[model samples]
Target: MTQKVDTAVVLAAGKGKRLDVFETPKPLLKIGGKSLIVHTLDNLKKAGIKNVFIVIRKGDFVQKRELIDYPLNIEFIEQTSGRRGMLDSMLSLEGKIDKPFYVTVSDLILSHNPYKMFVDCGVAGSADTGALVCFDSRQNKESGANTKVLARDGVIREISSRLPSYNALDLGIYYFSPKAHKSICALAKKDKTISSVPQFFVVYSQKEKIRSVEYSGDAWFDVNIPKTFIRAELYLGEENSAESGESKKERTSLKNLPKTVLLHNKKETVTDITVKRNILERLDEYEVIPSESYNSPHHIIVDESIDSFLGKPILDKLLSLGYKVYKHTVKAGENAKSINSYVKLSEEILNKGIDKKSTIISIGGGSVKDMGGFLASTLYRGIGFISIPTTILSQADAAIALKQGVNGGDGKNLIGSWYAPLKIIVDPATILKLDERWVSDGLAECIKQGFAYDKKLYNLLKGYKGDMKDLDFLESVLKLAIEDKVRTIEEDLHEDKIALVNQYGHEFGHAVEHLSGYAYGHGESVAIGMRVSAELSYILGICDRGVVDAHIELLEKYNLPHQVPKVISPEDILNSLKYNKKYYSGEPRFVLVDKIGSVWRDKTYYTVNCRDEFIKQAVEASYN
Candidate 1:
């Protein structure tokens, strides 16, 4: 059984030096359309937190007035020693919270429900003594925050604000039993110079019982700098704007559907002749095909034409390495995703005497990779395949996953396979040659990665100073992007659970792509989808507007589209959503941003059941 917390103490007295807004209290920073304090308050309320004690500076009367009109039940306590810093502010609230309580920073943005964390801590501490929220070490280092904890057999042995080498950082939020609270209070008095919560925790560990509750998902952010400030705003904005009704409908409609594969490829780079050569290379070991005779033979099927340049050179190098090369050229566009194309290519391969022993290499974006992988899977049972993804979309989400398919003319991927690629090679050098529009398209995918799995990636893009076309910068970005995909896929190759996090933008993206008739590239559609997902998550009370806003600002920074085009109707988008691959049993499962690097899939709604009114609102918000 979990212990319920009745009071929450929000530490708001710190004078944020890095934010440079000393004139205004740090908690008052505008995030999305609301103040930071409002976002924090909303999260507490959602978690069933009723009473909140906010510690403020004694002279910050103006800040107090600003928050007086808020809708929640809150008590403001002015700390006489506020200038002494965070530790003193917390100590000031010693006896104000009589019941079990939560302590958190007012400036931190929470993606997960903080109250839930508090409750989990209480439950865990029921047997132990105290529980503190601990986040991943990678996340802490990226944010330049500090945390220290040591545990044994689910019981914290020694918790420190300063450890030799710590893997988890204290999240500045904690659940305290009366006994633990008293111990902390005593530590505060003993260490008068201690300035942070972690330091006090270090002291209490020696005199009282304590344990660390590890938080696995995206839940916390310290918006202490200008960059993080903007990030918080963008995250909140997107959360507040996603389509809720449509997402529910899609989820409900997909409940009874069978899991199937869909394949799509570019027609511009593949032709009947190239297909003929591929078949011949497989069937006749002695026959050799001339690569030069095939038009666009070496042009990889990526989203941008620039990929062809990067791929052609790489193919030449592979050939130089003594590997036999086969070339295929298909016309560019979603129209290439037909049964006719699949059958025609299959017949050509069969005629050429190709068999299961042959290896297939895909060089393109998600479409080409899907088609190529599918063809490889169906030909002669199954064959080895490799993917050389040239677009950011494929590199991050679709590159290494063990799924591929082609969309039928009915606006859905109708045929495919669960074939994993042997390897996926991504070279951002190719992105430098892309047109600005395509670059923006790629940025959408990169941003989606940030939203679903890597806060460092998110912050890197937020602070990016060079041109998007800088090969060096793009290479570095691509490397980081690829690492995120690799990490996720390596942990969950079949997308059983961990990989679901990778779907952060695709739930909404596929619908937008279907409605747009592939006019927009996959990356562009994904950008819009991410924004919609964020908005829906906020409306459903899963996240705050600040998180949504952070997503929007990042999308806007890259000039990615956020709104669906008027040419596509809400009903059309909804209808197209019926084909979402995540649809389970009649419910279209939506992957929403719970916070930066975290995604949630809720199955309560029907697949393809998005309400018309909500879809309209989402489309309208996108334009705004």
Candidate 2:
């Protein structure tokens, strides 16, 4: 924004043969009572550009006559060069452009002036700093002649329309530097047939930095396409009506409540990821990670507590690499995962110009990871997600699975969905720095896993007597828990059936955690929930009394709670259970255990209906 360029080149050279229906040249086509070319001029004027160059086919007298009455300085150049692609259009500009200038393909219909946005993004005077305007194609599943950009750190690495697994689509717009125009002509002449603009950029970017700037809003469409022509008409008809109000609505949050979407099953990607070994090593593959924006496929979600600066070290390294980073912090703990929290953070990043092709990296314990996953899944309908589980609770359980959600209204994780992360980074150094209490809070999940599915894992935890501060020792315990967990969660990534065993303690535990106002840590609540599950199992004759005693003995041995605090009544816990996401037909369903190391399943599902009275009794039995 510090520098301003007043000139623009509008490419109107393409023939109207593709639309076959249009007898007029593509730029002469009419929409909303004005010619399409006029709209382009109006947009440029709004962006503060004064000089305009209209590139056309060599002898198009009619196209030139139609625009003769417009006010700006109009120079019509006859483009008589290669393939009629962007390089060919700009080749006609030749010596006329020797300064940084804006360029448009002329067929685009836009709701906002992109020129102003680019000018405001701090334009550089050099040729190599050229920027391309683009949006995440995956958001609307666009298909057509739109150019696809496959990039890293916001730099265009390769560009083409047929690319597989591409993240963004170029909007037929560009900002060319003074040096770039001459260099592009030289490259095009050397290749002879290098007609596509993106092709030129593909080769150009290898030697210099060509950025892909993310832009998304309503109605930025290629008018040359037939369907979009109709869509634009419909857009014009609805332009000033109340029904069309959304056209001007800011595009930061895509929808009101985050819709439940299933992301492509994670490829278990980026296995090379790790933490606390050497921070700088990550720069070898990834440069910039922005939370919830495609322009940044990389970002960090950290706990920004006064005393706890979890991801700061990682953020510092990313900043040093020249990655464009935005910090929108949330307080620590359970209350942090809420509808209000999600809206606040996402809007801040989106307002900061986060594009949909971004990858969001969340750094914290369970709560931050949970909220980060939700933000990643919902922003622009799902971006790449990475988790750095800094605590035992996250590393052992929360980080390994694909479930991502935040608390909704009154229930825990009532509004949520399954979103796979690119990778879940387990940092032993972070674990080494965790408080002993937090270490115990995470070990409880290991015990729950052992009692519900893996008896050997439970026995391993029961027998460990090493100091929690011993990284080598605690990591051994964590490794066993994670391995045992992966064995169950991998087959049922969404926890549709047998994987529901993962929630063995989460049913009552979630409600208890909420009702106690999170006075108890997540694992502590689960420990009590496990005790309740065992007691209910015993009452139902599913397990013997010895099984219940062993559950309490093992939990107490690990320093986790086997009983609920007396301050919270059983009635409050039952009241909160009504909001649990797993309930059906107004009945609270729970995963019951027939014995240690196993989950009791009904005829079909892993959860069973529990009477409120029985649940209350079980809750009381766990009360201290």
Q: Residue 284: error of model 1 in Å?
A: 23
> lDDT of each structure?
0.64, 0.74
Cα miss at 505, model 1 (Å)?
2.3
lDDT of 2 by residue, 1-624 (tens): 245688899988888565544457889887766888898899898887889999888889998899898889899988886374678877778888777788887776777677766755555343345555555454223215467777677677778777776767777778888778888889987897676788888788878788766664555667765545644644554464544567546654566776699578645533323434333336435533433343353556677762244566577666776666565567788766888988888887677655657767787888888999999889888877878777788888888777888887687888887877876667666766677788889888888888888887777777778775677766776777777667777677678577887888888888878887788899988988899988877654456788889888888887888887787787888788888767755667778787788887533457656456667778887775
Instruction: Write the residue-wise lDDT of candidate 1 on 217-246 in tens digits.
Output: 564567776445544544554465554356
Each prediction's RMSD over C-alphas, in Å, is 13.5, 26.2
Worst 10 residues of 2 by lDDT: 271-280
Per-prediction TM-score to the true structure, in the order listed: 0.51, 0.54
Q: Per-residue error at 565 for model 1, in Å? A: 1.5
